[model samples]
Target: MSVVIPVSADWLTLREPADAAARSHSLARRAARLVHPPAVVHDLGSGTGSMMRWLAPQLPAPQTWVLHDWNADLLAHAAAEPPASVSDVDSRVGHLEHLGADDLSGASLVVTSALLDVLSADEVEAIVAACVRAGAPALFALTVAGRVDIDPVDPGDRLFEAAFNDHQRRVAHGRRLLGPDAVAVAAELFRAAGWSVRTDASPWRLGGDPALVGEWLEGWLAAAVEERPALTEWADEYARTRAAQLAAGRLRVAVHHHDLLAWPA
Candidate 1:
């Protein structure tokens, strides 16, 4: 059995702004400099094509993007809202884990955002191997770094954080998700494969937006409770208190993440 985590278009839509803001522009510029014109960029786990919209302008013109995702609905949404700068867009519906060098061949760059952490170690290795074989540089962005800080701290914050991190690393359908360790693992793999890797902090400094923060808090607490059921009672209270703080404009959160760029050494 394969692990399947369903993602909604609403959730993707809600987070797109924050995702765009949190991405490392410096790293994106570096990636842009490395690629030649007429780029064929493959964005794995394309997720409504947010990565493409965010990155296409940074690259050269006459660009072609192959958006890869398993969800056809998301692909449809992506295809409908193609980036204006790109010359053409192609959608491939399938498991990105099954992708090989041949699939990525003729790619100038490979990219993904908020995707590495959800993948198992072996799956990540496969993607890295494919990138190497295709001789393509890669920019993997916004992978969670397993550290989150909420302002006006609560004692239960650490409790929920630990559990949530554990949940992120949980095994589903025989695959252990890499979670917070994803950036380090991927950097090591790229380096071992003779690729020069650079990583930058891309944490979301979330505040002033009640909807995004509240929704993120809800999901974060839910995952924590799911991982450690004993925290259910505590989570309820925590959620309520956080909601109150958010309403009062007192809640702030820094959800840490990393952006990694790798290229031939």
Candidate 2:
């Protein structure tokens, strides 16, 4: 039994602007240099094809994309809305564990966004092995670093943050999730495998969007309470206060994430 987190297409749409802002431009440029015209790219965990929409324009045109995800709905949404620059759009439905050199063969670049933290150490290792076997450069972006700062701080903020980070690291179905530790571990593994790796900070600085903030806060607090049952009472009060502040446009949030670029050394 694997840990499954259901993501709504609507939520992915809501975060597109911020995701575009948070991705590293330098890494995208570096990845562009390694490929020739008509690049063949594979986006792992390609939720709603956000990675393709955000990245296709930065590189040269006549690009081909293979979107990989286990969810049929997400794949459908992605296939329905491909970027204009993409010459071809294809979908593969399966887990990352099923990915192999054969799947990535003839690919110039492999990419994923906001996906690393959900994986266990073993899963990430397998991904690295597959990328290495395929001799493909990879750009993994927006993996959570487990740090968030909310302005107009309340007493319950740290409590919830700590609990939420703990929740991220929880084991489900006998596999321990990497959570905030994902970036460092992945960098190390890629380096050990003789790939040149670079990292950059891509934190989301959110303000002026009360609806998005409220939705994000709800999920953040819910996970905290689920991790520690004792946090339920405090989390309820905290959620109410946060909601009120956000509704009044008195809230700002900073969510820290890291992006990595790896190429064969």
Candidate 3:
């Protein structure tokens, strides 16, 4: 019998090995060119502060991190360790929608990790606008609107990805909006909001790795595929095949294309 995992705030915020610390360092290094030194940074939807743990070292000295999230449990976890290495740190327990220029008045750079695709275009636009208004150079990495085909060997690969990616673009703010090209939509929004944008792709290869991340990807993608009845038949097929492969110790990788940074214009 499969394990019946309980859903809760802290459990939901945990990261797998696929969420490599080094990947965030790469993002931070790329962002260094665009952001100024001695900056106050904000990580929107910052659950557990992993991005801060990853990116803070690469940035110049006297770095201040403002981690924003709606869950107090998550915020508490994030605040548990304000880096002895970092110059200063603050944690705000609140929703991202309430975040605006007033919240970011002193912030120079803003960042988000694995958070954008979960929201709609309008919400994302508003967040970008707030950052722009604050004159903060922003870096948003690990958003998953596009599914790059990393494991071509999976038989039901395209069938599952097609459905899930479709689900991503369907709704933004309780209403439907274009989300299939979520990263692209975000880049355009940033540009429209007077942000100079730079984008890139970071694919999470599941091969030659451990099993924890593989399980996470399987459930995550399967949930996305199951959301639409139009995809039910294909999703069932994909799930069975994928689960068997996973049980047999086969490969399952996920490609999460990341958009690097969109700076103030």
Candidate 4:
């Protein structure tokens, strides 16, 4: 059995701005062009509805959105803060792997942000199949692309990055996650299913924002250390040095991600 990891509202709130900044606007515009009026959008792993808030305006008005997630609390938060541009919002609290064509029966567009990397290949296939069955275009955004560049580069950057990527791909609760390879796998599946696919880079360039940078640094290093326990001693020193650089406003990081948009050919 695969377990869903609980994501906190605070973390979502913290990353929302960066996510908004990093998403591909041209893809959003293209998605808008693909959908007809009075659109019904389904957002898988919607979280606190940040994706809805960010994307609603780009879509046609009088829109209805079904926000799907495993966390009921987050669903409530999403429902409470509906986007002004949407006509109605519905919340579905369930695992996305169980989603089927019927669940997205009337969808005009299917969307998700920062979600694909955490899903297994089976889960990704299920989503693609659901979209194909429903005849809806799909836009998967902000998937990690296995690249992280930090300015004033340290010798350990590649080491930690590799370990962190390994941790991301680690099997958990009997499921093997796709991690950074999510975009490639999803693109291949979509293309195999005869969909027209387009992908664009959506890297989060972090430098001036101390809060986001600091938090991201901590999480990145933590994951790296978790995967390679032998690096604990060196990671501690590295973390400290990074913290000082962050405080001095000298650290810059480009955490690479990719956005994929697929539509029936």
- What's the C-alpha lDDT at position 156 in model 1? 93
Tens digit of per-residue lDDT, candidate 4, span 115-162: 999999999999999999899999999999999999989999999999
lDDT of each prediction vs. the true structure?
0.93, 0.90, 0.68, 0.93
Count of backbone collisions within predicted model 4? 0
Residues 73-100 of candidate 2: C-alpha lDDT, one tens digit per residue: 9999998977888999989988887778
* Candidate with the larger lDDT of 1 and 2: 1
TM-score, each model? 0.98, 0.97, 0.83, 0.98
Clashing pairs in 2: none
Candidate 1 Cα outliers beyond 4 Å, as residue runs = 1-3
Runs off by more than 4 Å, candidate 2? 1-3
How does residue 4 of candidate 4 score in lDDT? 88
**lDDT tens digits by residue: candidate 1, 80-165:** 86677798889998897789999999999999999999999999999999999999999999999999999989999899999999
User: Which of the two candidates, 2 or 3, achieves a greater lDDT against the reference?
Assistant: 2
Winner of 1 and 3 under lDDT = 1
Q: Report the backbone clash tally of model 1.
A: 0
Clashes of each: 0, 0, 2, 0
Cα RMSD, each candidate: 0.9, 1.1, 4.9, 0.8
lDDT of 1: 0.93
| Higher-ranked by TM-score: 2 or 3 | 2
